[model samples]
Structures are given as C-alpha cells and as structure tokens.
Target: MTSITATSAAATASTAGKVASPYNNLNETDFLKLLTTQLANQDPTNPVDNTQMLAQLAQFSTLSAQNQTNTNLTTISDQISKLTGVPIKVG
Candidate 1:
C-alpha cells in the first residue's frame, strides 16, 4: 500500500490551480483524499449538494465492497490452489 504524507498531499492539492494528485497512478485512496479536500475547502454558502454527497458515498461504498470481494476471491482461489496442489490463474 502507498503511504499518504502531509507534504505529498498538500503538494498534490496545489498543482497550478489543478487538484494536486499525489499519485503516479490514481487509485481509490487518492480519489478519497481529493474528495475530502474538496469538501473541506468548499464554500459554506455554496456547499456541495446533498445528492452529490450521497452519490459519492454510494460510489465509495461500492468500490470498498468490490475491493473486499476481490480480496476474498483471491484468498479463496489461493486456498483452492493449495488444497488441489495446482496453480490457479487469476485475471
């Protein structure tokens, strides 16, 4: 797993008017960080819409569940391979 550092996060959140991305390859963590920064910096008078927040939460939930499912499937496949004494090919 990649570590998130304050320096890196700040740097990424300040890239020439663009949202600084502290990742060579953007993933869920980076995405969540960016979302968090946006929420924190949003104008109080013109806050993010409730629907938008709910949508983001739903998307994150789906992503988390998908990642968990993938991990579980991988573990199961590994166990099956070990039990069968054969290598399993995962895509």
Candidate 2:
C-alpha cells in the first residue's frame, strides 16, 4: 500500500537524518552511528553481507584518517604562519 511505503520511506529518512554525518566533519562516532542505522534499516530479505560491511568500514576508516590528517596539517600551517609573522629580536 502507498501508506505503508510512505511510512517506511519516512522512517528511513528520519533515521538517516539522525545518523547523518556533518559536512567537512566526519568522526568515528558519526561513522558508527551511520553503520548502525544502516544495519538496522536494511532490508530483511536482502541484508548486507560481511564483505560489503568490511568495504564500508574500510572506506570510513580512510575518510576519518584523511580528516585527521587535514586537521593536523591545518594546525601545523597556522602555527608556522604565526611564527613567521612574529618579528625576531637580536641583542
């Protein structure tokens, strides 16, 4: 029925929103929440397999790592910039 489909779609949308990752900010918690929600809402008849899950995990891990690296690089850049801007004093 259309109502049933609408309800299912609505539920999926709500869950997705709850587990949605922040743009330009994807952390471990966001990834875990997303995976949990995906598993919970997956179709019963055709559920996700181990391989797929592993792939998704790998992808998320890579993304998280890259995000961390970018943050570290930004911090280092800022510190370097500050050091360069400061005038040196000589006796």
Candidate 3:
C-alpha cells in the first residue's frame, strides 16, 4: 500500500516520462500499479467496496478494448486507402 503522496508522486513521474510509458497515456502498467497500491493500502476495517472495484475493472477492460479497436480501425483505414487510392476516416 502506498500513501496518497507516493501514488501522486508516481503518477507525476510517469507523466514526466520517468516510466516506460506510451506518450503520456494511461496504460495497463499504470492501472495495475495503482490497483496494487490501492489493494495494499486499503483498510481492513473498511475494505474497498466490491461493486466499485468491479466497476473499475470493467472500465479498464472497456478502455483497453476501445484503444485496441481504434488502433485496428486506423490500420484498416490505412490499408483501405492504399488499396483504393482514397483516404477514409475511421473511428
């Protein structure tokens, strides 16, 4: 468990390119680091709410999916443009 200050410091460092991160983006490593810190520091007397934790996990999953989808779409769009000689935008 990390103190809030430690977590904040880590995030700040990450944003400053201290971590092997991807273009100042929040990636899986950051998520897992935060999650691990949270689980380590949670009070046993009042543990993290299961529902909230689940929701957070779900959100992370969805975000990963969306990022991958967007990357794939971009690649497809590029391929299509190359094949058709016309650029097409994809989301």
Candidate 4:
C-alpha cells in the first residue's frame, strides 16, 4: 500500500544521515559540533551518561573566560607601555 511505503520511506529518511557509532575525536574548536553529533547519534534506549559531558562543557567555559582575561591584560599592558615609553613585553 502507498501508506506502508510512505512510512518505510520516512523511517529510512530519518536514519539516512545518522551513524550507529559514537565519535571520539573531540577538540576545543569543534567540540560543540562533536558534542551535538554524539548526542544526536546516541541510542535513545541506552543513552550516554551526562556527567562527563557537563564537566567538559564547564571546562571549556573556564578556558574561554581565561582567554578573555589574558587578552584584556595584554591590552592594558600595551596601553601602559605606550604611556610610560618603557617598551614593556607581556606574554
């Protein structure tokens, strides 16, 4: 029947782009994308543990905050160098 064929087609379409395995290659830059993909591909009947994912997210947030602080410090240091003409170098 057309209805049966349509149901099967819909089911296949839904799973066409999905992988049955989880991804392990994660880095800071593509981390969010990888996380989302992992979540989307996970088996709903046996979902992955959320504790590790939450920790990773928190760590990434902390890293971002630290990076911002470092940039601000560098900018302030440059301004001070210009004012004092001391050729200050910050790393």
lDDT of candidate 1 over 1-91, digit per residue (tens):
9999999998976785675545646677777898899999999999999898889879878977998988998999999999999988766
Off by over 4 Å in 3: 1-24
Cα lDDT of model 2 by residue, 27-78, tens digit: 7888799889999999999998989899989988887798788888777777
The total number of steric clashes, by the backbone 3 Å criterion, in model 3 comes to 0
Give me the displacement of residue 56 in model 2, in angstroms: 0.9
Least accurate stretch of 10 residues (summed lDDT) in model 2? 82-91
TM-score per candidate, chains pooled: 0.59, 0.54, 0.71, 0.62
What tens digits encode model 3's per-residue C-alpha lDDT throughout 1-31? 8557888998887787555746458788888
Candidate 2 positional error at 9, Å: 25
Per-residue lDDT, model 4, residue 48, is: 83
Candidate 2 vs candidate 3: the lDDT winner is: 3
Better of 1 and 4 by lDDT: 1
Q: Which stretches of candidate 2 lie over 4 Å from their true place?
A: 1-27, 41-45, 86-91
- Please give, for residues 5-48, the per-residue lDDT of candidate 4 as tens digits: 88899998899778564434445768888789999999999898
Which parts of model 1 are misplaced by more than 4 Å?
A: 1-33
Separately for all candidates shown, the number of backbone clashes (residues 3 or more apart, or on different chains) is: 1, 0, 0, 0
